[model samples]
Target: MNRISARRGGASSPIFARSPAGSKRTRARIRGAALIGSLALAGAAHAELLKFETRPDGPNEAVVATVKLDGTSHDIAGTLAKPAKPAKPPSGAKALLIETQSSDDVKPLALERGLAVLTLDVAKLPDKARAPALRDVLGHLRGALKMKRVLGRAQGSDADAMTDAASAFDGLLLHDANREPAAPTRFIETWGADAYWREKPRVEFANGAPPNGRRFYLAGIAASTTATNCAAPVNARPSAPALRALFAALDEWTAKGVAPPAARAPLDADLAPAQDLKWPKIPGLPAPPEGARRVPKIDADGNEIAGLRLPDVALPVATFTGFNAQKNKKGPPCAAAAAIPFAATKLDREKNLDPRPALVERYGSRAYFVATVRVIADKLVKERLLLQQDADAYVAAARSAPF
Candidate 1:
């Protein structure tokens, strides 16, 4: 949130000023003060709150608190959103504390399930201090905030600290490589096959998942990005369908003692070298990247046959791939994934000599395509992988999608 401050002095740049005297006094300037604004306004009638207190952060809510660590006070900040409740407050007090950079999409998922969503700012601490700081913040959540159980999600980079502090949380989701969790601490690790990197993973997937330690390989999915540097259409499949259901399963496993869905990433065969892959000749498509960097064996479709199939993958529209062609002669490919739409009709497919089936041959019509998406979305929701609202949204977006 921008904390505005009054200024009377002149500066090189244009200064923002606030008018006073019933819209009659535009002053010299107004500026934002880092700690100064917050501290300066301390004790004001509407000063920011403390101890589960909150302030409006634009359209969202920001939970603000000050907690002590090693005799120093640190601002513990995060967006806090509570799920809708009836006349009487919900009997349970639970929350999910996620690192700021962790996916924001999952916040609503936790809220929908009655788990209050909080931010985990302790990851900003130094490596040596993050564990203790996380523990301290979590203690504050459970003790001072009166939350009975506090869950957490963080990126893989924070694994060391989160693992050390795992016992402080009831459940933890880390989007990183596999790691052994401290005993009795529920944990899940996820890697979406591609991170916005141009190069594919240099290593092959292996088995031996830890007890209660689940993993997901978002195969055939491109890393999420807004950049258009690729030679083809960017593939950004809606992760909501996958994540909605995944979060639900995670909640059931952590709160109700149910089992998480079996991990979907199993690369039984070693990755084959780029030169060895028997890629089909698709006219007009860029050549595959040449490197020893291997990939899991793929089916007729570019994606691996196993693992979770998002609606886009389950029902084909175009070849949705996380990998996009690098326009440069020699360097990393575009950071975004690509979605190459199939020909609209069999005649068009033959005209282009495209090996992939035409959209008409595959889906018949746009109406049928949308109906199929609804069916997939509904099934995922039933499996606890997709939320109903999100399912509806998917169907809605499908209606307007270019078939």
Candidate 2:
């Protein structure tokens, strides 16, 4: 009578079946990083506009400028682009001031909404001259390009440089920044909905530790990476749509004085010491790290309890986490998260001694699973947490998934 106990394939499997403990097909690896902090700035304002033109292969105006480092003559290139049509410098246009090199989505998505996009290669800038050089660049965009109001964008350590130069722009949209930019220069920080950095008991949340009203999640690396040492699949829930929607909100906030959605992420109560996390006893699941790191508390099903639950998180066929354990088991957790799919049915899970529910128990049929994704995605769109186009794409992907 326990006939559903034999077959196995996970979400990563070709048809989303069950993954047995011994199956190599279930493993996904990963590495991770990001944050914001403060540092002193140095150097003179040495910058010059180089060239502006419309590339034959592109539909938007191409802008090139340079900001020379203070002590050295090295110049960091900058690009300022308008929404559409081969054109010249813009006048009275709101803009997005990108700091570090970010995902390709931000520029095109913002441009699609008619907001001007300006990119600066700040990662290449020397540490000391960054703040003032950033200031000088903003002046150029405002004075020469006639940008009306501009919002700053940066991620990880580069986000800190934006804070050092925070006052130059109207607003700043940052990813994985730990500290909030001091007041008056309104800002919104994204800590990556999938995972966060915590410093044991001393710090419950290393990224946005105190939990500011303007901080939230899902403004993360456009794509997740797989590494050799990780124990399972990296938690690579598609975050492009979430990222685009967040940018749209920031654009409205900086340009038209609109308020973005309230912050949604793990609060003080949502975190626990690494060892204290309530992980399910899935057979062959890697052991968690034992150290000063803090992680999000999980539900009975072993998925995170807070933050933006994307389709993979909301309508889950597999379990996911922010930090994955290293295969060596002696070192700290691998920089990235992990993904492990559920067994095919209750009988299979029981036979395998897997505590997490089987996929069949969670979604009795493919129709229900796909419908739930649509419902969750539509809600995110209404909440300004996801773009409509992205929502449609997710649904279509679900229809074709090896359900």
Candidate 3:
């Protein structure tokens, strides 16, 4: 549904100087004003109809809801809960989180893990309500860009845009009945994860945007450039390689004039002409060894063991840590209350890497250990697959999520 509105301008009637033309012009103006008013009213009404609403059908079923944003007014539309399945979730199945462009992906991730998964339409946001919802994000970006130059400072412009997009996502999640109904702790954790995932792509795009030489723009471009050039050497294994690869693919796709993976348009099309440039390649690090998998591990099926590897020292530990999960009000009933950690020993002792005693000391247990892990999708996916074998494994591991 589309709504058309009129713009009001105040000016003297120059047409009055003329004769018959003046009378005709006055009639046209009146008609236009009336049309504009009518359209505006209709749009307001439609917006109200689509606002947020929640419905509950049964226990264990997902609640369906929708929220519509109107300038100062939030109207709820409909809410309904999905029914529970006959087969209870796997013993330790907690909440399942899925990222996709459609609902189809949600169902599978939830079913396979025997967990309830919530999906949101991240691409769309209520236009009228966007301002208030995104205020903090804008403020943060503005503040971050004001800092003095530092070697490791995040790029300002790209970071700001990415932050803005993330704030929009948070707004959408705020109204999502599914996310709303979840346990507060679970909801917060999931919200953070979702926001992180949503921001990654936006940040990459923001960085890839042509540089404006402004603090924020330069900050973003710098980060994006570093990720493209030094990803493998700096981060390596499990996810770094893939992260670098995905960005590289986007870079290549932009060069070829095709849509970059799941992106909306050519990478640099909207950026200023001066901002369009290729990322510089890092000088060192040998190309990926042919036919060697980075994070080779047994999959849920066990029959298939496939994973990504970067040159990162923490790759093994991070990969191991991913195999854990936490228990909460939302997931299964376990007396333990918290999930255990699965530490990675192989990567911890690498001579070239910094010694992160914190990783071992904090997460170390007689039975398991924790590796310094950064929470990202590529890592999450690999960890999720490993935990599928035993629901408890996922719960224990999730509790230890490093993010």
lDDT, candidates in the order shown: 0.60, 0.60, 0.25
- TM-scores of all predicted structures: 0.73, 0.75, 0.22
Q: Relative to the unseen true structure, what is the C-alpha lDDT of residue 249 in candidate 3, on a scale of 0 to 100?
A: 30
Can you write out model 1's per-residue Cα lDDT over 203-259, one digit (the tens) per residue? 443555677677666656754666545677777776545665676676677777789
Ranking by TM-score: 2, 1, 3
Tell me the spans in candidate 2 whose CA falls farther than 4 Å from its real position.
Answer: 1-70, 85-92, 193-213, 218-224, 327-334
Clashing pairs in 2: 8-18, 9-17, 9-18, 28-232, 28-233, 35-156, 42-128
By the TM-score metric, which is better: model 1 or model 3?
A: 1
- Residue 322 CA displacement from its true place in model 1, Å: 2.5
Per-residue lDDT for 281 in model 3?
24
Q: Candidate 2 lDDT, tens digit per residue, 1-403?
A: 0001111232121111112333332221110000011113334344322212222225433333344444353355555566763353222254555546735867777666666776667666676666666775565446434567777778766777787777777778777664566766778777653334422222334455232226664422222456557777676666566667887787777666678888776777776776677678877566664566656677787777677776667777777655566776686546666677788888988998888877778788778878989999899889998889888988888776544
> Tens digits of per-residue lDDT for model 3 on 1-403?
1111235355321110111346654564443333221112212322221111122434322222223334333322211123245475431322223221233312343344333333332234444433232232222212222211100000123222223333222111111111121111111101110111111212222442122111111000011112222212222112222222232232222223232233112223323221222212212222221221112122221111122222122222321111112123365322111111222342543443423233445456423432223333235344321122232333445455442
RMSD of 3: 21.8
Root-mean-square deviation per candidate: 10.3, 18.1, 21.8
Global CA lDDT of candidate 3, please? 0.25
